[model samples]
Target: MITDPEIDGDWDTAQGAESPERLTPRERARGGPGVRPWLWALGGLVVASAVWAGGLYAFGDRLSEPTLSYRPSKNLCEDFKARTLSGLTGDLHKQRPMNQESDHPAVYGAVCRLNNVEGMPDFVVAAQVDLHKKTDPSTEFDVPPLADIATIGDVRAEAVSDLGERAVVLTSFGGTEQKLKVLDGGAVFTVQVSVSTYNEKNGRPATDATAVQAAMIEDMRALMAALRK
Candidate 1:
């Protein structure tokens, strides 16, 4: 009775029996039936790229904005009032003081070098101001002063209060040189005074170390005020 389904008129039943499904010519031209998975993978990659780009844009904007409250001085030598140092040394060098200033997107800096008469006390005073626009300097601010003790013999460093967010004073070379550093917000201020031992041998009484440090602190406050204005 089953003489041969193919030869019989029931050929349609034989053709539909146990045959695997096949894609149309149109489907094959469009990358077969698995193309939807490929499209989904591509769409996921695009979304991830967009999210990464947005994050970078937001972070860059935050870094570009300045966080400092104080401003940079056009001429540090002219703006700084060295009354305390002048009172002790009599007068600064007649020649123009050496000064440097810079303004940039990430930072602002000013520095001034004031020296006493050649033979008087022969002292040198250096003042500097730094305004950080992007990052906080507190973590690294105290490292240098503290490191001096290990690097140099007879160096002393102590923390100071009431000057700013944080302050430090470093004295070296038997109190002949003193540096005062203060950090406020994102601004860093430093005042350093140093005198040579030759000045003591030349019959000029050695300047009082205590008085020198006090004068430095006083002048630093004045300098900060001037820059703020």
Candidate 2:
């Protein structure tokens, strides 16, 4: 007969079967599915990393700057034209408004004179805008609305000349860093002449101009031909 069997220890089975071995901590976590579950976990981690990277790229895509628009005004002028050489005689009359004292609603004004007797506005190319009037003539140089009235600059007639019995003159104004010019083709007897350009903003010019100085000059020549009596 065999001795009494030891009951406190593990046992083995017949047919080459043995008791199960104790699993290590890592082995316990990876039991059953072995490396398959670890491979699946790694795949999930890679997919999460890829999604995170994609989101980061999308958020930072718009790193460029935006552009602004600025359209300030500047003046311009033209020199000689067709009716220069003719000789006008006698004193020209000042043209006052028939009914109204001023062109309050008008944006532009260009009237020629045969004489300087009338206390008229001498601005051949004046665009009377609806901004607060800037009365200052020093240092600061900009139109109204953009600048206070006291700091605004000027664009006015700077000189006049009577060449060979002709009332040719040079007009200039300095402000807003722009140089505007007005050319006068003096007086031919009872008819005097002047030309000016409107203020421009941005790249395009004002659709509404106050003085078509050059056009007025041409018209004055035609008028002289008709009124040469």
lDDT of each: 0.76, 0.29
Residue 21 displacement in candidate 2 (angstroms)? 99
Candidate 2 segments exceeding 4 Å error: 1-96, 99-167, 174-211
Off by over 4 Å in 1: 1-66, 118-121, 145-154, 198-206
lDDT of 2 by residue, 12-110 (tens): 322332213655666666552234577878999999999999988765433222111111112101111123211121112222321111223221122
State the lDDT of candidate 1 residue by residue for 1-229, as single tens digits.
Answer: 6674356644444343222257677766666545567787899999999999999887674455446768788888987778887777755645468899888767789999987755454688989999988767765786765445565556678888789889989889688778899998689999988777524433344568887888888898898888773
For all candidates, the clash counts are 0, 10
Model 2: pairs clashing at backbone N, Cα or C within 3 Å: 88-188, 88-189, 89-189, 92-114, 108-210, 167-186, 167-187, 168-186, 195-213, 196-213
Query: Candidate 1, TM-score vs. the true structure?
Result: 0.64
* Winner by lDDT: 1
TM-score of each: 0.64, 0.20
